[model samples]
Target: MSVDPEDIEPTYRWPVPPAGGWTADDLDRLPNLPPHTELIDGMLAFVSPQTMFHSRAIDFFTWHLHSLAPQGLEVVREFTIDIDCHNRPEPDVLVVDEAAILGMEQTRFPAESVLLAIEVVSPDSVARDRSLKPAKYAGAGIPHFWRVENADGRAVVYVYELDPATRGYGAAGIFHARLKVDVPFPIDLDLNEITAKRRRAE
Candidate 1:
């Protein structure tokens, strides 16, 4: 049963696993899983299983982003990003500072080092990703976020920066894929191309 969105209690929510409680080893042993899983502030949240369309979009973005090679950026998939005091989420696509990944075979991203975090919103993830997760991302001091809503041909790209009072993100602007704008990866993303791809998929 779906909880009444309005009546759900705050405590009943999920975030990554707790400090001194969950380790990288524990995250690694998650069952032979299909959909990726991550612990955020001690809460176990299951990432949405990918559909073919989702996979295509992911592949396209990862390819393009990685092509910007040696730009001092790292593209990670389904990895835990320590956001802040209250949140640690594994975004579908995470772009972290290359300096942060050095000198280690494996390491957890310190909350502050993330340059961009992306989420592909599925039916189950819409509310949390739209409402709750953004707040958590902002609180952690991460500089940028992009959420892709796949219900339609276009995606809602929420470009945000920190809000000091609420300790959350305030949307800088909302751009749809059909529109023209430079996506803040410090690069130009042709949203029209994304829309065209979506159309081809349909």
Candidate 2:
């Protein structure tokens, strides 16, 4: 029988890391898996079940990005990025060059090849998405990052760009209603369309 996503638990704790630490190869040995699993600093972190609102937001943003992305770039969802031997994160949405994506053999893409990494926050992922990932992605030298948060049923986009000297991201702006930015590419997004409310049950 198919399992309802909501019925599943939020996170799974993997066993302690081995002497050499958890690597991408370790992920390959696992059996059937859910849609999202990440290795952060040698620890396995399972993504929580997504709410209808969260899933819709991802689809909306991904569609807009696909439509507006620059030539030779493609947007993908939940793609694993190998930041290092001990750190592989799966962002909610990511952008990478078509050529780089085509050349990749392993399931995970090299962090340096990504143009932008995006995360859409859920209640369970607030800390990792808001703070942990920004620092991790910046340290890996990914040039751009975007974070989407849902507040009171509206979507908010936070933009960031890497500062090469510090290897960290500097805030560009927080956008609502409309999102406009120039980094990795130029694009404008309508948050209203992206975060349209779902129908309520009677």
Give stretches of model 2 more than 4 Å off: 1-16, 103-106, 197-202
Number of backbone-clashing residue pairs for each candidate, in the order shown = 11, 0
**Candidate 1 positional error at 82, Å:** 1.9
Which candidate achieves the best lDDT against the true structure?
2
Model 1: lowest-lDDT 10 consecutive positions: 178-187
What are the TM-scores, per candidate, against the unseen true structure?
0.71, 0.86
User: Tell me, what's the RMSD of every candidate?
Assistant: 9.5, 6.5
TM-score of 1: 0.71
- Model 2: which ten-residue window has the lowest total lDDT? 99-108
Error of 1 at 113 (Å): 1.4
Alpha carbon lDDT of residue 141, candidate 2?
94
- C-alpha lDDT (0 to 100) for residue 179 of candidate 1: 30
lDDT of 1 by residue, 28-135 (tens): 555553446665555566765567656655665677667753577788766667654335577777788887886656646876778777777777787777877776
Local distance difference test scores for all models: 0.65, 0.85
